[model samples]
Target chain A: MTFGETLAEAWGPLREDAIQTDAYLEMLLAGATAGAAPTGDLPTVEGTALIDPALVGAARALRDALVRIHPSFRFEERLAGRLRAAVDGVALPRAAGDPIPFRSRPTDAAPGPIPGDVVAVGRLSVLAPSLPEPLDRLPRPVLIGGAIASGVSLAGVALVAWRRRPGRH
Target chain B: MPVFGRMRRGAPADRIAVYDTDRAAVRAAGRDPRQFEALYRKYLPQVYSFAFYELGNHHDAEDVTERTFLSALAALPRFEERGDGPSTFRVWLFRIARNAISNHRRSLARRREAPAELADALPAPLDPEHLAAERESVARAWAAVARLPADRRRALILRFVEEMSTAEIARVMERSEGAVRVLVHRALRTVARELGARREGDARQRR
Candidate 1:
């Protein structure tokens, strides 16, 4: 194989099946033996080297380019700080085994529901004091006055509806 | 099973254990936010590097990296370990980073803002004269990389920059292992050809 091809194969992802092969072993041994050689310089493998310095140089240059662009230390610190603040903002569940505090219920908790007669007063349902006597037993003057008031309101609504009816010119 | 057969079947036992540890770490982080710091510290450099290279600028890289981690933290509660190994978390994280980069790019496109040049994104060398001389060549190489199709470019970066295995890359990319191999091979060949052409042009100019 050409030197460029060899380098490419060597640099490429090592397939599991390829790792056990004689060729792979030989390549590994050659690489191990050739350790510390300059980037483009061909290592003296036991066999014919077929090394192309230019191809090796180009590959190294590409590798160098990929390595050159990285996050600065300041950027790392800034990002880490931001991440720490984010973690802190969350009310994370505490680590296990913390003791729970005891508390006592108040003797005067909210008052229970009121006990009284539920009387329908106009549109509202109100809980008020129970009447001492039935509706028929109420004072004659009070009953008569409420009846007159209800009649007046009903008459007023009827009069307005009649006045506003479509056919009434 | 024979050793060769075992090797061919799956990742080595030690590698699998490493991934198992990663999955455990991910689960811990999910359960407890405090545990997330370990994961963040371990992957910060890698994820940041991937972002910087992909976006070709520090500003966008930082933006995407921030969005990526925040999104990861928010979603960690739901991240299930599928026993696909440690690559599951790595792939999952990269997936977030990938989406963030895409959204950033889309927003930039909508605003009609051109991305910063790759050369500008690169840190200047300490030697001023050497940096001045090397700048064009580095820019040319990056420009060629930028010209590649998005998937191809990403595959190349994941393979070379992250130094990921084919299986790991396949997991991240959600592609078949064979397809990843072919994609990386094609990408490397393209880069080689581009560099070769540049060299010839430079030689001609010198003559």
Candidate 2:
């Protein structure tokens, strides 16, 4: 493969813990929006001691670019009207938004993965434990003690009931 | 409600509610195409934004967005909501959008890329300094993102723009969650490098 192709496919670890990068991103985006004011400090993520501040800012910038772009009112309403009419001849109120201007094209237009093309029943998984981890946390001794105590109590109650029989009295 | 409401703590519940609401809307829309308005309004911004970012202009975005809903309305009768994850309705809708975008891309392959003017966004910021800085940053980021390969760019847009979880993105991208992570990681690294390099270059030119 060419160097560009090789570089395109290659990736590095997010941190030693190998926690998912998208999770960190979710945290970063949330943090960036909450703060609003530029802190100049990189957002800290779990399982990583250091993060490149530039990366954080770039992610934020990309998000900002996306957030600002909106469809024109005419187009939105026109489409809404068309869709509304298409549906069982139902006419709906017109839709509207601020008139938008020309914007830059995205570098790539391929949808990557078509959701309909996916027919696999299960997601990719391998070497996962066959059995799930136990959800019960009580220690064996405590369980046994509780069971024995309950059994003894039941026996005593049975004995008392036997002694209180009407024929014996 | 806006496509993505205020990100509150109950996001998971919000997600489930979104799924529940989508299925309900899908059911209603299935019966009556007019009922699809709830869904169209809910997802119009998301679908349009996806196309706008992907296609890079209002014209193509509108086309793809329109095709997506039209196809969705036509296919509503067959859309059976299965239990896979949240936003099955959206996943279904985006699936349609993804296909429409692909077809549109092929048709326009020979055509020039979508025309874009980055200076003015929908609502211009009041402060000139803020506006200029935002435009520069947005331009830098968008250009760097545009440089990415198709899959990587799509992954980044879905992750950052759509704010989808890794699993959800995986579902949308038809890849494993692990693979989607790598795509986003590599894409982010690449975009960061470009952003940093461009910033330094601009500074040097100014000097």
Candidate 3:
């Protein structure tokens, strides 16, 4: 189909998606706020109000352009700038290591070497625990043993004091 | 698991900024959900657009977008701001999106559908002058994108459409940024060459 036709077909869905996104974000806002009470013990409330309609509108604009533009036009630099402003303190970085090349999946006919970015990120995920808490959940055995040792020493000191009391001697 | 005992030097300034911002947002999220709402509002667009471009379907994109935030919220309490200098959050979010899309593709063999009817009113024959004015290339460049291998298509979409940097792309692609750059560069050259060939064909027809 022609590019216009492709765009035309995609526009309705895209706009719908945008609206849906707004609603979803609203839901998230409501849910998050509902859980945090009015006078809760959270940090300073500075910079939280920045996610306004304006930011959403900018995001929509960027989304529309991405769908509309040709693949050859690189928009990373410009897009990063725009997103930086919209999110107000968020910066998205590109992969900076040596190129690993693109390798296709063996099962599909998609296309050399798998892109290193994917592998590196995966490696981090594998290495980094998804949970913020360390898997070092169980108490350190050595520390526990030390605590026991300290307790025994304290008990011995108490016994010696009782035995050396003047009246008992 | 390559632990750089210290943070890398010469990282993107924006990355540091993003980490700083997310650190506060994440901390707020842990303490108060409302505060986290602030972050949701802030990053939703970036997250949503990234999912949309990568997934290419309205329903799946939204699903993934919602899932990304929900998961982020659930996991927020433990999120540490490594101060890696860029919003690894966006990368983290996109990685979630990439996984969602990949899973769907694997399960359903997701194919690109024609753009919806809403695009019917769009003008055809992309104005070269308009594109040039924007420093944008010809519209035909997309056709080449359409013709790319699936993995390459994902890389191009992330690089061109989502406008993710090589490192961010690497995070999303689970590959090194260099790989992403190489893939993107080759993809662009391929698309340009494809367009050039098409133009030559048109000239021959005229002759």
Candidate 4:
């Protein structure tokens, strides 16, 4: 083999495994941080290194380019809150305007055997009192009035549907 | 573990930052979930950054970060310490993040929307034309890096952005150290070549 090929054989493998090179650079950076004269280690890398020093420098600097852009501070805090809630088993609303689901499990939710009562869809069953706490605040009369209106509206729709059945005029 | 003892010339080893174990934090968090704030604050940036780079969007990154932490916090009680080191917890957390990102990607595929490109923001604030030029070059460098294949991009980020050693990166990426090294070497070369080409193109335009 030519002398150049011989040198290639010697250095080819070293360039691939940069473990030592990285160790040296790390130690060099550490030494500089310690306020040593800060001169020795860099030159050693530059002198003996076959790979371009600019390439190595560029690789090191890439970290700065890929710098950790943080989540907004608000996002961080909100996520922390959610994680805390998760730990406590408090079911918080995931999105804005979404009703905070009851923490009660499916087996625990007893939807009464009444028409229009939501059969528990897994953990999502909107059990009457468990969900509509706001309705519980209104005066008893308004709730009664609203329930009567809903029942009337439902019966009217049902009566019209039966009268418009296929066999009826 | 090789300990870098405090350099006693006038100590070449000026003491750096504080050190704490993931194990201790995990154990504390497991006992009282409230203590988890320590681990949450510690790893939020890392997990968020990983998802951001991998998914190339802030919203998805936040989603993944939130999922990873929520899931981790729930699973904390069941977390058995496999070893006496700090990184076992870190590795586990990253694995969780990796899974979350994959699940997200699957859903994203169903939606059929292209993942958004990463925003090119300068790392540090700077002013003046020279500083602007420097930042632009840095942005271009990362853009080149971002265009690399996923494995290569991940390896580069783990090695550089996360400042993980090859061994650590291998465990995180679930690859051999030799594979990780090859990924970095090829990624660097691709980046160098792309940057060189861009420079040549700019020079031609100038002339």
Candidate 5:
């Protein structure tokens, strides 16, 4: 393999700390020897000469160049200031008697009834049974008239129910 | 083994401890907005640097950074902590920054304005007298990075510039760890080849 390909292959492992120097040297040596023809069980001379320090140096130099060119902008103070203002805006103090902000919760969990709705329901429940007490205190003539009216109303309701009842036809 | 198990095994114990501490801080921030200062202080530089590098200008970077933090603060209440790891917060925050950058880029494209060069994005104080000395190499490197495929360039920047680990990068990039590694590998190879070719051309020019 060419020096560039060899460096590329070794660069990731070396940079990521996955391989130590010994492993790198072994890999380089293997790459160097891969193309040599075997001469009948003879011990091949270790070709350490093919391992040029210049290739590794060049790779490291390139990495350094790239890193040096990484633009450093000092926007921390400005950004933090902006974030502080934004956070303050979001976390503003609630006014007295203000309702708590609505937060999303699980769909299966039902939300509690509103306070105003609860108060209206309570007032209705309390007033429903006492509604007839005022009518009971009417004068005798008025009470008699009310009874006659109630009877007429009951008769009207019975006629309507009978008309609408099933099998009436 | 679970995916997190592999990550945990690969990560140093101290790193995991720091991650846990950061996660706790995030949870505290969720409960009390005042506590969010800790997170904002901690990740401000990282997020800012990422935005600056990605967008290649401080103005846009600051704008995006502000939007990212504001959006994060607004959404903090809904941030659920499953006791997974600190990567959750990093990933979530970076996703916000990435989207902001994308929107900024789209707007710029609509306006027909090109992003400034990476070197031009440096702050005034960083523009040393010797900047001209290293301009050629820096330009070549920046150009190579710009020419890379989008995902590959992002992966490379997150890996080298942000000094993020593969697992963290995968979380931010929303890719598998294997895919991130392949991207970095290919990106590095491309960059090396480009630099080598440039050097050869320079040599020929000198001759």
Candidate 6:
């Protein structure tokens, strides 16, 4: 390897980062636009004028010079692998269809609003059935709690009746 | 303006003309999705390079670049016209990249893994003497950068590779311009010392 080769090799990883950046930007922009699709071409020098033209030109020159000087620059594959690993490490947003290992239990899932020990005590209002399913499904926690209270009340009434009976042996 | 105006045509070059035309189209699209895609086609490479250089690793860089454009598009509705609008836009995008890099490093640190070693992992060459010497310098520089106290490395990359102005860096790093300058100075000093040590080792080997 020559000095040029060394410089090129040093700059080698930078190119993959650039290409990935381009792809990502294209995806993000497409997502943003709703209908804008990629032409499947890498963004070219002509498109770079969105930045300062001089700087864009300089950057291109740098990349070209680095690549030419060190044509042996072979870090692209490894860089891509590491990039994938990093994304994995950070955890990308998973597809909704992806299997989740655990589902919440009814009681455990019933944390009353914003999570933690504050108990809400009042007449619970059930949202109208016409409301969206998510909204309709809510307040179930309060409803469950209501059932628990009603059962306790019935138990108390029976106990009182038994205590008051005069026929007790 | 006479001599210069005469030397160069009053009208801009074809590339500039294309850029101005494209920018107009993008601006016209305003809320239109196609217009933003045009903007992406026009500038994706530049944005990507800037993000990649700052973030060091491809994944985070790509994410940052993607998010920068997304945020820019989302905020386009409120993008006010200013005299230096294009320059401001570039700076804004880079600022996003800087923030992303910092956040990436922070999260990685929390996970207790080496922050996905930014330097290429390929074995350094040992063939030619000059190549070996230069590789040593480059490796030492990167190693020094990696070992820098967080604040200094941030300052160094922002100052040198990104070539951002002190004020711009101050905004991104959330430090006073004076503080950023100081941090950069210290970072350079550390890097210089490491490079010098490597050079000395090379000289000793040659003897």
- Stretches of candidate 3 exceeding 4 Å from the true structure: A1-169, B1-19, B81-87, B113-139
Best by DockQ: 2
CA deviation > 4 Å runs, candidate 6: A1-169, B1-31, B38-56, B80-87, B109-116, B121-130, B201-207
Better of 3 and 5 by lDDT: 5
| C-alpha RMSD for every candidate | 21.6, 26.3, 24.4, 13.4, 23.1, 19.2
Q: Is the docking of candidate 2 incorrect, acceptable, medium or high quality?
A: incorrect
Q: Between 1 and 6, whose TM-score is larger?
A: 1
- The C-alpha stretches of model 4 lying farther than 4 A from their native spots are A1-48, A99-169, B1-20, B81-87, B110-117, B123-126
Q: Give per-residue CA lDDT, model 4, range B93-180, as digits (tens).
A: 8878888988998888453222235544344545666677777776787778778888988888776666676777777778877667
Estimate, for each residue in B102-193, the C-alpha lDDT of model 6 and write its tens digit. 67667764532223444463246777665675454444555656667778776655544444556666766667755665565455556556
Instruction: Quantify how close model 5 is to the true structure by its C-alpha RMSD in Å.
Output: 23.1
Give the distance in Å from residue A165's predicted Cα in candidate 4 to where it truly belongs.
Answer: 46
Question: Residue B124 of model 4: what lDDT?
Answer: 55
Better of 1 and 5 by TM-score: 1
Say which prediction, candidate 2 or candidate 3, comes out ahead on lDDT: 2
Clashes of 3: 38
lDDT of 5 by residue, A1-169 (tens): 9999998897666445322322332333343346433222223234423323444333343344445232232345334433443443423112222221222333575675321111113212111111111111211111223445789999999999999999976
Instruction: Please give the distance, in angstroms, between residue A34's alpha carbon in candidate 3 and its true position after superposition.
Output: 38
At residue A76, what lDDT does model 2 achieve?
62
Query: What local lDDT score does residue A59 receive in model 1, on the 0 to 100 scale?
Result: 43
Question: Which is superior by TM-score, 2 or 3?
Answer: 2
Error (Å) of candidate 1 at residue A65 is 1.1
Q: For model 4, state the Cα shift of residue A13 in Å.
A: 3.1
lDDT of 1 by residue, A1-169 (tens): 9999997786564432222222222343344345634244443444323323343344455555665355665555445534443554422112122111111223674553222222234633333332112121211112323455789999999999999999987
By lDDT rank, best first, the candidates go 2, 4, 1, 5, 3, 6
Better-scoring candidate (lDDT), 1 or 5: 1
